[model samples]
Target: MRIEIPAKKRLVHETRVPIRWGDMDAYRHVNNTIYFRFMEQARIEWISLLQQSTHTEDAGMLMVNGFCNFYQQLSYPGELIVKTYVGAIGRTSMDVYNAMFLTSAPEVKVAEGGATMVWVDLITDVATPWPEAILAGLR
Candidate 1:
């Protein structure tokens, strides 16, 4: 059976990153491993967006789980726009949806995925609930 995965245009925020020559593999395209770095960049932008608008004291949010699906090939020397958004906000975890697309070809979806991050106490290395202040910002 054929599965349908439609292109989504619900980017809450985006960051432009230039592809480096080192990102290419022997296949002459961006390496699959490099996608994770793109995801990391999007996640950092999402976190910073929250931090800047809110006054939360806790500055630590750790990724507990994440996965990605490579849809198409991305070559080096092209600009990649990493779009990110909060998919869901749970009691102690936040689900972030992210996608990487070519700046010149926005319709072409390069990759799409998500990450689940839990608010944690760095000193204790324990998860904690989403404070009301943070939740409000997420909404």
Candidate 2:
């Protein structure tokens, strides 16, 4: 099955992640789990930037859910361009997505995934509305 990302999702971050040899299985294609990891790396990178923009260590994002859809097989010895998108911003939560493609074939997406993330006050351990800086950063 295929899942479609938001047509109007904002592109928030982009990074390259090299495919490690050990990321593959006996079939020589990348394992399913690694795709989630790739998406995770993007999310963490973006969230870190968001936190920096907020200039606060007391607030952060929590990924309450995640998922991936693999449309093509990826092999080792290649690099992936991960594009992160964010949208559906709510009172305390937002939707995040990643579309990954081989560096050599940018037009062909190998996998895509997303997570529903919420903002939280780390010290109080409670959900909070997104900080203004974080909201500005998203836009």
Best by lDDT: 2
TM-score for each model: 0.80, 0.85
Q: Candidate 2: give its CA RMSD in angstroms.
A: 2.4
Model 2: per-residue Cα lDDT at residue 65 = 87
Whole-model lDDT values for every prediction = 0.76, 0.88
Error of 2 at 114 (Å): 0.8
lDDT by residue (13-89, candidate 1, tens digit) is 88988899999999999988888888888777776776643223554677887778888888878999898866656
Clashes per prediction? Answer: 0, 0
Among residues 3 or more apart in sequence or in different chains, the pairs in candidate 1 whose N, CA or C atoms overlap within 3 Å are none
> Model 2: runs farther than 4 Å from truth?
51-59, 122-126
Local lDDT at 65 for model 1:
76
Determine which window of 10 residues in candidate 2 has minimal summed lDDT.
Answer: 47-56
